[model samples]
Target chain A: MSENRVPEEIQENAAHEAAKLGIGTDEWVAQHEERTARKKGLKGVPQFIDESIPAWARWVVLLAAAFAFGAFVDNQYLLRIGVNLGLFVMLSYGLNIVMGYAGLLDLGYVAFYGIGAYGYALMSSEQLGHHWSTWLSVLIIIIGTALLGYIVSLPARRLFGDYLAIVTLFFGQVFVQLVLASDNITFPWADDYVDITAGANGIPGIDPFSFFGHKFLNIRDYYWLLLVLVALLTITISRINRTRIGRAWRTIREDALAAESMGVMVNRLKTMAFVTGAAIAGLAGAIFAAMQSAVFVSGFDMPLMTMIYAAVILGGSGSLAGAVMGAIVMSVLPEVLRVTNYSEILFLAVLVLTLAAVGKSVKRFTINIVSIALIGFAVKILLGFASIKITPTEEWVVGPVSRALSHWMYVPLDRVLWGNCAFVILIVLIAYFTTTTPRIKTILLPIIGYLGIFLWEVRLVTDVNTTRQLLIGAMLVVLMITRPQGFLGKPRVEVL
Target chain B: MSEKKPLLEISNIDTYYGVIHILQQVNLRVDEGELVCLLGGNACGKSTTLKTILGMVKPKVGKIMFAGEDVTHQNTPARVKLGMAVVPENRRLFGPMTVLENLKIGAYVRGEAAQEDLERVYDLFPKLKERSSQLAGTLSGGEQQMVAVGRALMSHPRLILMDEPSMGLAPKLVEQSFEMIANLHSQGVSMLIVEQNANMALSVADRGYVLQTGRIVLEGEAKELAGHEELRRAYLGR
Candidate 1:
């Protein structure tokens, strides 16, 4: 204990030195403590959440909640959404291995999913007059897609970055074309054209997954199966991420030349990553085909690919839990948007949250909200004085919040045009706001906020599909500006 | 010195990038348990020489013998597996990875028996042990250099190829880096260091080769090269 303690003479000498510097020891110590406290405060809530709970425990709790929700939920629509979330989770996980871990931009990932579905359809349906067992069909499809992935990677081995993306994207387009043209294939040896993929009409009456005669006919049954698959895949992928192969993938992602110099077989590991991702996507596709009891060419198009990429990127591409969370959000957000009242509530809540987060002070937040209200009322009064006919509150407004705001906001008869113009002006204002001084920015905030509400309530809300996409784009843009690493991705330090 | 076995010998290597000649008829060697430094000014093909030996760039006309085997056409990973390690230019540390992970990657060819080597590396740089969990990018320049050297040592290589180890270090740290190199040389580890800093490199090397415009203009014992009038005027600045 004596050895561990500072000597009394040394302590007195430190005090003497402090006195010589015109400061007391206590004052200096207090300042040091304050700096540390401020540093801790900067870590904030997210850091608290990260540190207070172990990852595995959090995962367990999340999975348990999902299981309880799925098991007891009565609505079929909700069950369907759960099933779709599980499917997206599977696809996002697959894409994560390629783009997140290996840093390969495989734009043709959905083609593998399509292949799985089509393969399952051909093997287990009346389309080709073959009815193989579901298990056998799924197994063969998974292997076939993995083999296809390997073949695709052979040409991709020498290619990198944008070139790889271009080639894979070409493969995706080729797959769609082949599927479309296969319906009228005329072999050189054959005299007549043979219909194969049924063209755009697609394959119908696909067999449901059956385990010893217990057919998974109900959406609930498929939901449970998908939930299990997602759980198993999450565990498997996470385990793989901790292994030597995963480390090699990450090294290659960081710098391939350095990885190769370090004795990692970069090409082989890249192919392995591609194949693994393809196989996972293939598995999801097989289950999707079985669940729908049909396969369509349109189902595996660019839009689905975009959604999967969005899920992976939004969740934080390299993170397992991030992929799942991103999938859930991407899948369910549109469904929530379909209901006007829910989306309205969601928008308002998000708006308030953003203000609270960005405002930093209570006074600023209050001022912003009050200014937005005042601006809305002033605009309404100005329009009234000009003799512009405002639509009655009960005519078009559906949600409670929108109805209440009808008094303050001006809803024109030609809302679509007004909303369009407002949207453009809002965009310009936001752009200008970014380039302005802080004082101008504060002045512009309420105006922009009021215009955003106008655009949403009057125009954007009616066009659900476009609005959903616009929201996603806006989210991605904001995320890139604020957190380029995504929600859970660790910020990378690129070599100079 | 003549009886010493050559661990790596490169003869008459000609390297080109799209018909622009980078290295022409370059010959170099590092002997067993020897510290050899390749000295040159900027863009004198010193890095190219190292890359050619490492099988990163294919030489149009050359033979490379490493540890008594002809390895002229082998790939980078194959060369790496044949007991070669590199502390590349700019350190090239996996910036997002931990210090320990970067070291572990150096043993990729050897597989999971690097625990002992890891301990040895920790012994060599005790500062690294305390910062093992810290990301390599966040480390100070001296600490990052320590990790780079530690990473190379994890491979348990027959020879290490270092490209500009002193390039980004503080002046004081440069002396420390050379001391670390001298310490490793004393422990019987072979090394081939490519450097523009001739005075520092020659101070610790046994043999030295001075390259000029993709040609080896001078080759002799380190003391002889250091004392040579022409070498001193161009490189030593004396």
Candidate 2:
């Protein structure tokens, strides 16, 4: 027992060694572990939710809900919106493969969609005196568009970043110009000029999609068709992502040179991405043309391209679920904006949501909202004293939300002019608010809130299109500042 | 050392970036199970030699033979499949991807049957197994270096080309890196390491080649190169 017991000096040296190694006492170690565990518990909640639910289960629930909504909903307008959303979802998925997975900036992606539509239109319609079968036309369009996409991406193979974007953009413009000008063609050996695309008039009388003697007649039919296609696409793309090809594509996106050195064929994979994306877009285009019973070059213009890009970005690039969610939001938003009642409700809801988000504390949020209301009433009274004629509520305000807002907001007789002025001033105030001190920001918050409502009621709501664009722009700016990775994307750490 | 079989042979190769010649008459070789270091100062075309061997940059003249086959005109992926792998400068791990994903990407040519290689990598660097799910970019420099080397190993390459394995690592970690390289060398894995730290590199390497500008200015056994008066005066800071 005496031999087993350590000497005093040896024990002291052991303690010194433990201290030198930064190994704390048992209690201290336990306390440190507890603190770290608490922190991890807080962070792990969201991640736990993510991991607990399998991706397949979530997708099943989502698709089932979508299917139920489309199947039962009798309203044609709503069904049309659903169908259009499905179309946009398909486009986003296609773009996600190219720009998200492979990181190629194919600005001319919509051109593939246009080509598919036109190809289907020509093959199925009497435009070129051709009435190809529905399945055959769609198959041909998909294959032809994929080939075109491969050819288009050939020149862009050596390009990167902005240069790649420029080349693809040029291709997009070329597609548009070719479609526009090809309406009239007089060959040296021809007797009469040929009408191909029919110019600005577009190609009309395109056949509706029919399979196994079942014609897709109603908006609901198209909606169901799109939903099926989207579901299939989702499964296929996600499967591809989990496979070697998808990993190769992502590696190329991350670092092409590294991917190449790692034995991933960068150029061939890039071409494959382009072709797959183009083929998907082509399929969507053919369906879209059939649904609309026409194909217009204008329909596949910059605005549509912008919407698809915005949807992909908003949803979170490189995420399949994000693309679908973004497509739903972008597609439904404009339609919601078209209706005055829905638009008013949306505007106020967003305003309140923004306030709640910015003012994390309930007290701060309350103070901001109260101040905004007080300022609005005070401004109305001041305008009354200044003899500025306020418009009567019954004359202009239609919606219940607008009617409620009319009491506080001082809508002038010439609201359009007043709104225009407020918009410019609001822009300046927002710019100033971002750069100023916190105290100044508190003061500016109420003012900005009041002005935003003022602009919405007085000017913006009247111009639905502009308002939608402005709102989307503002949303993107805020999202970029707060969460650049978007709703579903993982936060990436770039080495440089 | 007897009857040496060169796994990678770059003979009188000249490479250019547009009109600017980057590597001139760069003749180098790595035999099976040998550790060779390519030593040079900054911008002395050390990296270009690695790139040319990997077929990222096509040499204007001469040939590159990998595993005794002509790979001069072959693209990077082809060369990689021919048993070449590079631990690139700055440890270019896919920042957003996990350590395991990066390793899997290294096995891109070999396909999904790299589970055995993956386990081997983890066995070599057990700490990497713990951090396999963590992003490669978020790892410490030493850890990242391990992942980079592990990633190269996942390819099961006959010749691993390391571009500055010691760069951006602490002094202690630099010693550890060389030790790891020495360990790998002993395991019969061939390597062609490009380095600016002549001392550490030459210590682990069996033989070394010194490049000046774009040409191989000096080539000898590691012991001789370390003791050379001119080498000591220039790179060794004697």
Best model number under TM-score: 1
Per-residue alpha-carbon lDDT of candidate 1 for residues A93-172, written as tens digits (9 for 90 to 100): 99999999999989999999999999998888888898898889989999999999998898778988899999999999
- Tens digits of per-residue lDDT for model 2 on A1-496? 1222688898787678667645422233224335324224323443454567887887999999898989799998888888899999999999999999999989999999999999989988989988888989998998999999899889768998899999999999998999999989998999999988888789999989999998888878899999889999999999999888998899889999888999999999999999999999999999999999988899998899999988898888899988987898899988887887888888888889888878878999999999999999899989999999877888768699988877777889898899999999999999999899999999999999999999988888778778878877887887777657766676686652
Q: Which residue pairs collide in model 1, if any?
A: none
Per-prediction share of native contacts kept: 0.50, 0.64
Clashing pairs in model 2, backbone N/Cα/C closer than 3 A: none
For candidate 1, what is the total of clashing residue pairs? 0
What is the DockQ (computed on Cα atoms) for candidate 1? 0.33
Assess candidate 1 and give its TM-score to the true structure.
0.93
Per-model CA lDDT versus the true structure: 0.86, 0.87
Residue B78 of candidate 1: its Cα lDDT? 88
Residues B89-190, model 2: lDDT tens digits: 999989888888888888888888367898899999998898888777666677788989998888889999999998977565788899999999999999
